[model samples]
Target: MFFTPLSLLSGLSPEWQLVVWSLVVTVLISVPFFVRHFSMQAPHEVTPFPFLDLPRELRDIVYENLIQNPSYPPCTPSPKALSRFGWLLPQRPAPSTSNWVMLSNHQVYEEYMDLLCKQAKFTLTVDQKNAKERDIWPIRSETLKQIRKCDLRLVTTSKMLGAEDPRTMPKDWPLRDKICERLRGVQKAEDLNLHVRAIGDPLWNPLWVWYHASQAFKDSAKPCFQRITFSLDTWSPGENLLARNKEGQWEWRCRENHFVATDAGQYLIREFCSALYAECQDCPRR
Candidate 1:
């Protein structure tokens, strides 16, 4: 028979009843704390994952699923960088979740970083302001060495726009020279993209002048690019900035051949076309 506390205490003396009630109250209060303390002390069990046991091929697939972004080769000056310029500037995207996942362990970190460096296409931006501070290659040489493809954006200052001939650019124009110097260190690349905005100036007008003035295309000895793509800004329809020749090499050509009927224009076009073929021939592809 279960006797309630009130019923049991009813038969006891006043002093005895008071002592029993006090004991009951103490037990009730202590029970929760006792349970909580033991719960805290008990070790949590973690389920083991056999990720490391997987084959290298399978692990690469997993790494690619995690880290390879669709909008890859994302623009730099990340959100953190923009914060320094005041809140008015548009916020850039944060690093992908894969970046944080790499921090899980040293093994994962090394493997993921290696894959990222080798496979991912990187955008290398060089501006006059940042070049002066010697901050062109934001990443280390070790990481840069693994890069296979690059989208190079060279932002020229307004003052540079005034130069009629890029070849005759003053000695003070060290920014372009500095960029070229840095590029010389890159051992190889599958594709090198030079943006129209970067090379677009009064000097590059008529397109033929690029072969004579641009150092990157002029120096065939460098032999770094397997394929060099120049993105052009054009309003004309059916105007292709590049076309594959009979020999399978990409060549720059103006669609409106009759438009450039002048003897000088035709000669310049021929020179540029010939130079393009030579540059492609010299660049070794692996």
Candidate 2:
């Protein structure tokens, strides 16, 4: 016969039932205490949010969409600096919502930075006159170590510099040399493209001018870039500034043929073309 609690209690004497009920009450009262004590000794468990549970690829896509392009203020004279040096200063990129997510926690920040520095291409502008105020290398050293490709835009014109000082001439080799020296510390970069903006004189041979300018970064030692391309910007107004050519090379179209196509340029174009074709083959049109 199966004995249910009701059947067992019914079989007990009235006094025995009262004793059993008291014992059951005592056990029930102590059970919560025992559970609390054991739970206190165990490690706390954290339930991850739904977003954190997403796949890595999906999370990266989310981060990419959240990342905003930095806004650059037009180079203008600060009142104090204008009074002191009588020249405009090169402005740093205005604070933006670019890396806000990276400020959350150490692990998340590191992962975000890794994706940004490794896979993304960064454009950095350097003005010779405002070199002291504006930094060329904006990313932290640790982050920069992960960068593989960089575009260094050099703005060395008199108008940008805000003075016609002969010493601060655009063609001065010392400015380029200094910039190259600074770049040598970026030892992990594989490719460096130099985009130069300068007022060209009619007497100056644009090819030789750009060649000498690029020669500063041809170092084989530290921060040695595997490939380098130099392009001259004629600063044409209201035109398509940057475009990819048939060969998959990003060309800065100038009104004049400012860039003298060298072996380096050809190599850069070929490499880009190969990468494009490889990507196309890997992921063909639907």
Candidate 3:
């Protein structure tokens, strides 16, 4: 009689009501288990985000660090300095204390990054390596933890170094010497915590020739990326600014070959700011 009245009130059969009540209880009791199971699963790997066409602040940090800083010091160019032959960076890249001259590697803390800028923008900071070790290898525990969040990679790919061209190599191959790796990007390079940058060949993308001149990164923790950025679905076509030579190393080319070529447009700074805001809402700087 009790079952009959409950069924009449609910307008549901006794068997169906039991099933519904069981389902509700199961969901309430097992939610924690479901969350735990999902959390135990390994997180997926992420592809790098392309920043070839980002704002000036993003692109010019290399310059500000090695060039604009008065104490940063410039790399001393050798008497046969490749720079004099148009094979090097400009004085604007280094601090005034630099010698502006060199054959050997300029001992900057940000080697691969400076190399990339010198190759692309044709500049470096100081030829002198007299700065504190903290300036060069700033990889303190805090900085390392930050850089780790970004996919780490190395440069020294000859093509990006602008040192080797395959046409100049011996056909037998393997005879040409090229060096890669060891330069850290975010850690020791500078102090910005969220500054997502890399100093080597094609940071995340595995398919491209002029891979080192530019890089891509995504704050996977951000709402826009969280799950989508690392997936194959989010990988987009990138613009490479270098040509691969016969030596199999990627080299940096001029910006003309890129997808979004920069054009000469004159505008007031306010207009420029307004337009930029209209477009890139996620940009961190003004």
Predictions in order: lDDT: 0.55, 0.54, 0.32
- Candidates ranked by lDDT: 1, 2, 3
Q: Where does model 3 exceed 4 Å of error? A: 1-74, 81-95, 98-154, 157-239, 242-254, 257-286
Q: Top model by TM-score, which number?
A: 1
lDDT of 3 by residue, 148-261 (tens): 222222222334333354223222222111100112323333212111122234333322211221221121112111110111123433222323334423333232332222
Itemize residue pairs with steric clashes in candidate 1.
Answer: none
Best by lDDT: 1
**Model 1: what TM-score?**
0.55
Output the worst ten-in-a-row residue range by lDDT, candidate 2. 275-284
Off by more than 4 A, model 2? 1-50, 68-94, 133-135, 158-174, 200-211, 219-221, 225-286
Model 3 poorest 10 in a row by lDDT: 223-232
